[model samples]
Target: MSGTSEGPTPATDLIQPNVTHSDATPCPGTEQIAVPAAGQTAAAAPSAPSRGGPDAPLPATGGTTPMAESAPAPAGFTGMDQQPSAAPRRPPAEPPFRSAFSAAPLAMAVVDRDGLVVSANDTFGALFGGGPEEFTGQVAADLVDLTSDPRIRQAYQQVLDGRRARLRCARRLKHPDGHPLWVQITVAPLAPESPNVLLSVADISARRELQDRLRHVQNHDPVTRLPNRTLFFERLSAALEAESYESGGSGRVGLCYLDLDGFKAVNDTLGHRVGDRLLAAVADRLTRCANEAGHGRTSVPLVARLGGDEFALLVEGSTGTEQLAELAESVLTALQAPFEISGRQLSVSASIGVVERQAAGTSATALMQAADTTLYWAKADGKARWTLFDPERNAHRMTRQALVSSLRTAVDRGEFTLEYQPLVGMDDGRLRGVEALVRWRHPRFGTLTPNRFIALAEEDGSIVPLGRWILATACRQARRWQLDHPDEPPIFVSVNVAVRQVWDSDLVADVAGVLAETGLAPHLLQLELTESAVMGSAGRPLQSLRALSDMGVRIAIDDFGTGYSNLAYLSRLPVSALKLDGSFVRGFQHEENTGENAAGQGEEHDGAAGRPSPADEVIVEAMVQLAHRLGLTVTAECVETCDQASRLRRIGCDTGQGWLYSRPVPPDRISELLGSRC
Candidate 1:
């Protein structure tokens, strides 16, 4: 009643009733009514009940006696006759409504249209640090911070205007003790015609605190406290979506995929505890680097730990590759210093792959893939560096992988073939031997050369078996040629050997078995090894070569001058021939004064005028002499011109191999050459 209308409308004007008597009660033919308070208008008052002469024993129309209308009215009650009661009725005992309002658990308050508190329950008063009497008449808006939020104010207004029956929101309340009180406030009109609102508040601070902790745990890494991969990917997706809207899909995005070099070694050698500490230190440094890099940018880069020994940075709206390169450089420089953990100074480096592209055509998956591939490239190109994404390089790598995957089966499928290149005597121009070059007659990429798949086989250890196959095939072919030309000098067949074959395979036994199976003389089957392989030969490798030499097999050092030309070391090995590298042969044709000296050999003139810098010629002449003195034959490789051949002959070289004689041909072509020589 206190907040029914502005200034408290009189009790008579507040209650409006259309009263009806209940026939089920013991009050037949009698009217039960609520008499309006003082100052009621006659039109608003109920008609006076007709008196039936002391109610005529209260007519029993419904088998019940009616109350006499002449009964005395309670004190302070106004009857229909507008007569004062015989005695002023004592004020009604304390109502149940007041007891309920006082006992309500939630903080409850009644706010009038003027936003003033008309009545507040004890809970409301106690919650705000006061009693009900002290809170009464206070401006409700000033008592709490709800109106500070426009949304809460709008909700309040909506309820006040009757547009909404109830409105609720969660907001922080201003407290007298200056402590924050989070609460859920609900507003509802007290009644259909009431101008007052029933506002209720419930504390929710504890729930909110729990939710905040959960969110932190979900989005962060436990070890580093940095955002984990989940949060990083979420942010990356958001940034990409924002770029699509902000720049018409033209914004550039960049990512740096990083892996710690030799992280496994650290984990294995130092134990996981030390590895964990090192990982934490690395994470901290990465976070600092990302922050420093984004100093002046609108969107800060997000650094996250993808997993063990792996991390990434998402750069939104990147300027270009140069910017990404700078970021990568910073990361590398930061990790250059040693990390002291558990009293041990551990030095580590990282390889980063950077990828930047227009956000319009790229996706998170594709971007991450490119970055990962680039990172592998960095590791492959010798760790501790950064490599940019190159589509061409990726394609090439994919092709190499495809070839490697197919190589093991290629041998079983018999897709491999061989071509023979003649090694012609430099002086006589006759074939002394033929080099067997392996080729892959692939079903997809037709006829791949050995250079393409041989390294793949070596890396995967498939070369051991492939090398055995080649050795057997070459020996059998050479035996056939030898048997066909019984009356002619036997022509030898040289087969290249991979280093892995020498180390991983039983080279001595394989060669011996192949020679016995084919009945080909070991001397007529030459095995050529690159200079590095020959120079690095030691222990078992050296013993294998000596064993082959003892078996009457020819051992030649191919590509001789490119590696460590340790003459003293070379003379001690079981070597029979040296094939001069082609790079030196290309310089031969350019030299003047191609005249043969007095001994039918090139002149040993140093810096002769009009002679192409005798540097290469001088080196070749010296090598030929060295080989001859060691009782080893010297073959000039890549001899493509008559001048090159003549120079080699004058330099006292034994043989020449190049396109000038004939490109590498099939075994049938070699057989034809053999027949012609015969």
Candidate 2:
């Protein structure tokens, strides 16, 4: 009944329809009116309004009318105000409800009680990657991909049946184009008497990704962008049990453990930010290298970060130790390049220790132990290189392990012993003092050297206690020797101090107490330290060393050339002597073609292996000369023959200590050496 008018002059030819009114009256509240010619049917209504003109014709009904069919004023209409009669007006049109869904922002779908899609908003259509027309007649199940939980269907049915006020679930939706979107959907029943149910979906993809990102950060190191310990152990455990390796014959696992050399200097000199960037850059380079170096070979390396300045590669299914060695060499080569970080071109170097063994019967602890021990050797053997695990080295390690396992009880059991290596005066060959080295007489593994177990003690933090026992035992021996040779000059005792002893216990008090307990004069005692151990001695280190030195106790730099030696720093130190590293003296001696080592510069460092540069004997000689010039006594270490010791004595070296004098003999032998019996 609502439409526009068209022109029709004929009155008799008008058609009849649902909305027909022959008489034209003033519109009740509206100012418009429609009239048809007299005797005309609704369909034959005049096209134009007569406007009270008798000559006007009525509109015809193929929907043509002057008043737009005039709609019917109203069924109950009466003349306005009773006294002044006027026609009532038709009602105004209201917009359709379903049409508004076209522009809705949120994805929406209209479903019947039977769960069929009665309609869909553009957004809903887009959510399924289709148009409204494509979804209109589709079943609700058609829009929900296969990933939807079957349980969700029951929930959806509950929503449609009004058993639940709303059905909500978080699910990953599959798009028509195959990309997935995480979504939170709420399905609710529509209005009463409406056959439809409403589904409102929100794309929660970004939020889901945020959660995943948080999880990733939780397992990876921010500095290196490598999997940290948490993730490393996680993957290791998985590998231990995973079926992926089950398909092939079981192969042994190998590990390449590495530590950075001079990385701390870079961190201390440059800011940590630069260090972090450097670590990230290194991580990237190493990962690429590990993968490229026969990645899928017998042992493929899984590189991971293990805290600061440490990294590891897990070689799963390594064919043998050789494969791991190849991997290690590749890694070393990969890191040989200069790294540009924070706009600084810094040369970074690393030392790596390789331990390869069958994962069979090997616990993570065992593997880590072997790797760690080898790592120490790599560093001790000199930095910027790699070393493979040797069973011979491992046998030595097992002995040390036994010692460490027994160390905590050795003091209580009296299994700990000390053998003194005499520090002789190079000029006079007089005993300066005996550098006391501890040994262990294990019930199972015989006498053990200090090098065999000292580091383990240090690692387990047992050095503090073990070192105390060594000090006490050596002091007690010194006291006995003094009493035995009272008429002769009193000999001093030199004790090695473990770095841990300095940090964990009161070294000053410990040393003072030991001397007092033994009734030995302070001047008769000396403490030996490796170069690095004393390089940047802690404030406590300085205090302890000075406290002992002030009491007339001597302090000496042990293995001087092997560590980060800063001659300037040593000048300000309270040290009384410098023990040249063994490498220096040993390398300086050469045998001629008569099957003797030619002592020129000595063989290049690993020159046999083409690694670090050759050991420079001239440099060692220069160091000995320089130390004596500084009023510091020079002790030549590892002098294997009298000739080498003689050369050292000629070089003005203040002392000589090594195999030539006797391989660290027991205190009884020292008594002979000092008592003029040797």
C-alpha TM-score for every candidate? 0.67, 0.45
Task: List, residue by residue over 1-678, the lDDT tens digit for candidate 2.
Answer: 111111121211122222334574545433232344434453454344455454345432222333323354444534332211354433322123333454667887767777766666678867777666566556776466422577877777777787778888888877678888898887776655444677777888999999989979998888877889888877766655542357674547778999989889999999898888888888998898777865445544688999999999987766778878888888888889999887789888889999877665667777788888899999999889999888897897676666667777776788888888887776677776787888878788787777777888888888888888888888889889899987777777888887778888998888888888989888777788888988988688888888888888888888888788788887788888888888777655432223233343455433532231135456777887788778787878887776676667666777788877767888888888875521
Error of 2 at 197 (Å): 51
- lDDT (CA) for every model shown? 0.81, 0.73
Runs of candidate 2 exceeding 4 Å displacement: 1-405, 590-617
Cα distance off (Å), candidate 2, residue 574: 1.0
Instruction: Write down the TM-score for model 1.
Output: 0.67
lDDT of 1 by residue, 127-166 (tens): 8987776766788766766678888788777887788888
What would the TM-score be for candidate 2 when compared with the true structure?
0.45
Q: Identify the runs in model 1 with alpha carbons over 4 angstroms from their true place.
A: 1-212, 245-250, 259-285, 332-350, 379-384, 483-487, 590-611
